[model samples]
Target: MSTTEKSNEKRCERDGREKVDKFRRFLAQFCATTVENLLLFDMGLCHSFPFIIIAALTGFPNKHNLNETLSLTPIEASWLASIGYISEPIGSLLSALITDALGRKVAMMVVNIPLVVAWFLMYSASSVWQIFLAIVLLGLGAGLMESPIITYVGEISEPTFRGVMIAYTHFGYSLGAILVATLNIMMPWRMVGLVCMFTPIFTTIALCFVPETPLWLLSKNKTAQAEKALCWLRGWVPKESVAEELQSLQRYSERYKSCESCIKKDQKCIHPLPTLAEKLKELKRKQTLKPFSIVMALFCISVFSTTFSMSTYIVQILKAYNIPMEPDEAAAVLSYVNNLGNISFLCLIRFTGKRYLYLTILSILFLSAAVICGYGFMVLPIGYSSFPDLSPNFPLENSNLGYIPFVCIILSSFCIFCGINSMAWQMISEVFPYKTRGTATGLTAALSYVLSFIGAKTFYSLETTLSMPGVALFNCIIIAFGLILMYKILPETENRTLEDIEMHFSDNSKKLTDRKIPKLDLSQIGSAKNNSNMPTRPVSIKGIDEQNNKKSGIGCDNRSFVADS
Candidate 1:
């Protein structure tokens, strides 16, 4: 039978529009909530972008115009970098408290304050050293946006749709990277300061109407408020349905009360860490600390092994090729190509591919390109090919091999911005549990900056020590390992229920997403365990966002065929 036939047959058997409609509606409301929440962090880059861009242009260790651009001795530039790093994590720490208290919407609203102030300072910066202060302010703003946005989105969204929302946020990060790459080309680095200044204005305006999360209110024991929030989130659901959902909320709430009460009464008997029982309750308040650490490590590993430094130095890389152009004109061309690469990346997100495969494929492309470029330099005579050895300190097309790798980096960066960026956010969301998601995500972002800093420093440091191809090859190795881990440990969670997913993780079954909905929710129906103490019924909010297919998964044909019936 065709899909329509099977659906029609099932429809005939069901005989009730109300039931089907309720399930479908709930799915729609929660779709992509995580993505929007995560995307808000793009604003964190308002200050960080300028700091990194300015450093790339002038503070680069071996550059010729360092004294001219910075108006400082080369040694002073090192001091400026130290100031930038120390200033960077301040905003992230400030964000943690607000994210848990005021919620994501207000937290994001608060972040604009620092961003606006940081940008104003950057626009007026007089010396490279002055930029150190600007970066510190920017980091403070970034810290606020990162954790709350993740926390708010994860909390608001249903469990099944989580990965897609996270992927959307990852996409936002790529957009920010693209925005900076473009801004750098269209205007002088100083004008880039103005753009950062205004990001908060637009973000704040849009967030004014963002809904408070339903689950968050319930956890805080505001049952009436959770119901009201859900009504908006699940428009068109019948009034009777509200009562059912509210009942579920009550039970879920009591679970929280019971756990908290248990903690208080038993004290030593209740494990401070997540016991199998409290783990069921998500009672461990501090588990976010370790996952946050691992995620930061991963983010740093990523930035270090990638191309932010090289892209900022594109003109230099080409000049190293000894191509024939005045330094100023060559710089202009490099800026134009950088813009081109970014444009291609943004288009690719809505075009040829999406978040996951786009990531894996892009990683391969970047690695291949980096290796090709690295090999080109490594094979060249050490003095001439590496730097200072070749005449006029530029490649004059003797072997022309260096140009090939340079082209590859440019192309690979374009692919990476669109592709791997998507994959990173998608997996990060899945790996993290919902309750600690904000803290985990905050740490993820904090480390992302840390890595970006390291990546920037290492890109330059490696440039001097290793040939270009050598650097590319090393990064390739890193990406390969990341890809392998993802394939082995991760499951395809395109769509699944919150409880259904919990069961999978608890069962340690990586094969769940590929199967039909498990028997967990069904078994709860009319069970004696559905007593006063617990209300673990399947709560489906119709017309809500979760019903939508957030991740764009491949759906199979719905058919029923029998043999020997």
Candidate 2:
């Protein structure tokens, strides 16, 4: 071999090694966000597909020729649309237990089972009852999926990127809305349902490849598993690379575990498990309750802001009340604009401290727009009566104000998509501590859906009695009340870590000093000659600490523990 050939071969080998190392670095960086993003996106799709299917179905109510195929009455159709909202609370409760017990991955996969059944049921259904049942099933699936998705994503992502992850999920929902609206414009509703089924199935399949969250594994006392999970979530970094993160999570879980165990021992000197009341009391501590309270209020505001109401039934409401724009066209436009607006606003969430401003101002704007649009409906209908010579659809000829409702609808949609909808969901994901995250989020979600169900069920009836404009005016009042209440309370969570946020609640500024209870040696007391006539008080951890502290006259010194009876 020649010297020239040998030198050339060595250079080529060095170049190949450099390229491989570069690719490895890229893959490691990409995998961290990529796996989590995909999981969240899939769950987002699962949450939204049912809503998309129903929204598309409501876009047009013509018999079997388009979006609405079922021959059903107004009230019956309203029941069909509202059933999902009604069923979600039940699912939320179930998800809390499932996610806390079985792990987030299992809960995610379990939710898909019912979603598949619901979509499949709707695909072949012929009766109103059958369709209603399917919607109920889908609602259950949504309820079950909500807590785990938000909780799991929040636990898994870094603080710097958490808002973006949440925003992406919101974007996924808007994308689903846009896709279904666009597809229903060209395809049948049944086909949309069939297509929607693919999301949950694919989500389940994709989740199989991802590990459980490190926090969840840690909570289960599986330290080894938690380390491996952390490594995977960090993009296959060396186990040593994630050691700091793993230690932090373990410390958190251990602290929580310590706070949860009973300190009192029986005569046998063995510590028993904490009672149910003790657990509930622990959760009610200032750190947990404060955030939980704030989150619940925001959750209520998010729902009543007409986020779910307008998203699901804007098409039906407009078409039923004789609005000029095509319902499906309006939905598609609204979803497209919503996605764009959501993306734009989400970009600002991390950079700005204007979350409260954005929420309050935009929410009021949204509800007011709804009011004006509703009034347009009322005015347009009355315009027909005013002009005896013209038809109802000819309101544009009489006045240039005909475009007011469509403009208001667009304004309302822009406000909601741009601010409150995404903010509220992201806040819920950020607010709760890990110990009670599932329970608090689940309960708040259930309550949110309760408000949603009320709005959905009463929308048609409210329109019937008060006209569309009147209903909007009514919702405006309710939403304004909520926004005002929220403004006084909601905390800014942008670019903040989970621990940092909890510190605000757990910090020493509150001066909630623990009252020192001197542990009494009961055996020593039993043998004391001076306490022969004293009453023996049972030492239970319930309200015992308070009662004993108030009346037991217990006193202590450094050298020896003493109790005054």
Candidate 3:
């Protein structure tokens, strides 16, 4: 070949190598992010293990059944199951404060302390009260970590990958449920607690190696540290590769600070620190109010839809409905399906928009509930009852149709994990602005837990009062209502940046056209007129003064403005 031909071939070979190398870097980064997310969210196992174990203890035909071992009554078992949720609200509230004040990493580490203690307590418990106390502690730990974990994942992951990463939190919960379900069938509940307790300890150690989120670092004005953290999170890519992202984060932080300081072009001077009333007034901002309302409503819908309540009392519910399977076996199968749903969520989140996916899930859930409730009313024998006595040995007519309710329950579980659960939790981290993220997420999460508490606490009673069919009907109504509200209000957030999601809720954003204006450096603007290489434009002094007066009742001082070209 001629010299030019050889040179062209060599350049092509070099470009191919560069492309391969870039692909390798991206794959490595993705893997590292996946591992970090798994570690950060492993507490999902600890959070969910207790509920299953409690279900097994009260209802499963195990050698260490709490109903027999400790003479635990149904009421006591119900309390053990529902108490965690009630305590979670308090933990969530505390988490909001801790995550904002101490940093997300510190808040995560702090939560492990309670988790370890709660699990250890459960393992060594001899009395019902001890178990109750352990669950309360577990709830507190679960609540405390919820905000930080969601915030950390949201802050650390790229927007392109954020939906999948956030979905991993629910993945952790489903995996935990599966683990505990399998372990519950194979071993005593105490041993299950002991096995699961190690997760939080491992999480604590794993967290030591991970860096704090770059967003949180930037919020604290730790620019160099933020750069380092961002680099580390992006698989330790060279600093220049992430500089553009870092600058964007800096701009977001500055914008937040400017908003906090009440700085605008219309204002004549910078404002001082806000007073107590002024600080409270910030809560009324459109960005805060709109997202907060949407999230809180979603949480309410999720809580009342009987998703968590069913999980918490899976064994009892199955036995109540006279499903033709061992409660433990059904719980295990449901747990597996739950993970499958979460996996489907991870796979589909990239391909689907948030609003569409959510609406689809709710529709399926509503249909599933309707099927189950209809089966109960139409097919069951006339004296069938689940309340006052929940027994796995409850008799059903000998027919293949007995499996239909079980199938519907399984479908509902899948829908819950796939979309209902993930969407609500994902939005908690995505919807709020950085300044109020911890507080808003905390409050919303706390309310969610409280609603979960009510749902869980009332499941058994509702079964007693309304029967399984009635409970299903209640969920159907709530799901339908939620579906309508969500369809009307939820914005599509897939593949969108946090800034874009926040802007979607702002009235001002809707009124303003998309425009990019040059950022003026006040210090440099004064010197622009004297620079030989720079082109300057004249000031519109009267226009500036009139605009300022119209907005803030203040007039700008007479000064010549020079715009640089």
Candidate 1: where is the Cα deviation over 4 Å? 1-48, 51-88, 158-162, 235-301, 309-315, 321-359, 366-370, 378-392, 398-403, 497-565
lDDT measured at residue 72 in model 2 versus the true structure, 0 to 100: 56
lDDT, candidate 2, at 484:
63
- List the lowest-lDDT window of 10 residues for candidate 1: 556-565
Comparing 1 with 3 on TM-score, the higher-scoring candidate is 3
Q: Which sequence of candidate numbers ranks them by lDDT, best first?
A: 3, 2, 1
Q: Rate the local accuracy (lDDT) of all candidates.
A: 0.50, 0.61, 0.70
Query: Global lDDT for candidate 2?
Result: 0.61
Task: For model 2, state the Cα shift of residue 287 in Å.
Answer: 2.8
For all predictions, the C-alpha RMSD in Å is: 8.6, 12.7, 8.8
Model 2: colliding residue pairs: 374-469, 375-469
When 1 and 2 are scored with lDDT, the better candidate is 2
- As a whole number from 0 to 100, the lDDT of residue 157 in candidate 3 is 70
Clashes of each: 31, 2, 0
**Cα lDDT of model 2 by residue, 131-200, tens digit:** 7788888888888877887787777766545666666667666776676667667776777678877777
